[model samples]
Target: MKQQDNRALGAWSRSSTAVLAAVAIALFGAAAWHLGTVALSVAPPNTLSRHYPRWIADHIHPELEQNWKLFAPDPPQGNGQIEARVRTVNGTGARHTAGWTDLSASDIAAVRSNLLPSRTDQDLLLYAWDYYALWHDQLPGHPREARLMAANLKRTALQRLMPQYQGQRITGLQFRFRFDRVPPPSWASPTTTDRPVNQVLPWWRVQNKDCQGL
Candidate 1:
């Protein structure tokens, strides 16, 4: 009986080792496939990359898509920030516009001096604004993308700035972008100067549904 029990234990150990080996192989293969697809997707337009554009895109889009521009060669030369304000209607039906809230500044503040910054603070509004800009060129253009971004901005404002607008119903939202080009070093261009450009967009009407859940 002791010999039989030892034999059973040996068999179980072998089976467990085989199972673990198979799982490791599967995980390694999955990682390899993901990395390969991501490489192909971000690589410069080559014959192979061009051939499997759809496949590569399918594997590494909207989530794993890489932006090489974040590094050297063509990094952002200008800093851009988005600010927002809300047009509110009081309980008595009086309309008023609130002070401009620096949304980008708030995000920067949250990320600064924090070891583990929240992803929402880091990427949420940043990516939303980037995608919105990609889909939109000018004010009153592309209602679909504009409405979506407006809703997101309004939701953010409601959460962050709600205390300031107590008793007032937010009815509209406005956005503006401030951009400042980095001035060249004095040694490089002693006379060069930089200026900040402020682009104020028209107000977007917000409905109750836009801020339904805050």
Candidate 2:
């Protein structure tokens, strides 16, 4: 009986070892595959990625998508900001134009102090503007989602100024974009003078419904 019990115990130990080894192998394989996919996604176009573009896109898109805009051979040389002003109608029907407010500055300030800033602070305005820019052409051009994007941007600006304009109806909104180019290093180009460029958009009339609930 003692010998039989020893043999059974030995068999159980071996089985457990085999199961653990199998699990470890499976885990390692999965991890390797994941790393390889990420590497392929970010690396410059290669034969493997070029051959299986669809497969790689399917693995990384919409969530793990990579953006190399800020790094590498071609990086952004300037920063763009959006500012807005509102036209408010007082109770007596007097129309007033508010001074320009730097909406992007508020987002930048929110991110400066907090260790973990919310996406609203970091991406809300930036992404909205980007979407608008992507879908719309220059002024007077109508494209799909162009009007909608404009409305969205105006809505956000209105929401921010609602408290300040209480009792007055927000009637219209206008946006301006400024791009500030970074000056080259003094050692590289000491005479270079980088100036900010501004483009002001026409005033867009706002609907009463759009102003509802702030």
Top candidate on lDDT is 2
Report the lDDT tens digits of candidate 2 across residue range 1-214. 9999999999999999999999999999989877888899989899998898667655664347577654755654778898988999999999999999888897789798899889676877866776677557543343434666776777777777778888998888889998888888768864545878778889988888887776
Candidate 2: the clashing residue pairs are: none
RMSD of each: 6.1, 8.5
Q: How far off is residue 204 in model 1, in Å?
A: 5.7
lDDT of 1 by residue, 2-66 (tens): 99999999999999999999999999999998988988877778998878766775566445768
Give stretches of model 1 more than 4 Å off: 51-55, 58-76, 79-81, 89-99, 102-128, 134-159, 167-172, 183-214
The lDDT of each candidate is 0.76, 0.78
What TM-scores do the predictions have? 0.57, 0.56
Q: Flag regions of model 2 displaced more than 4 Å.
A: 1-76, 138-142, 184-195
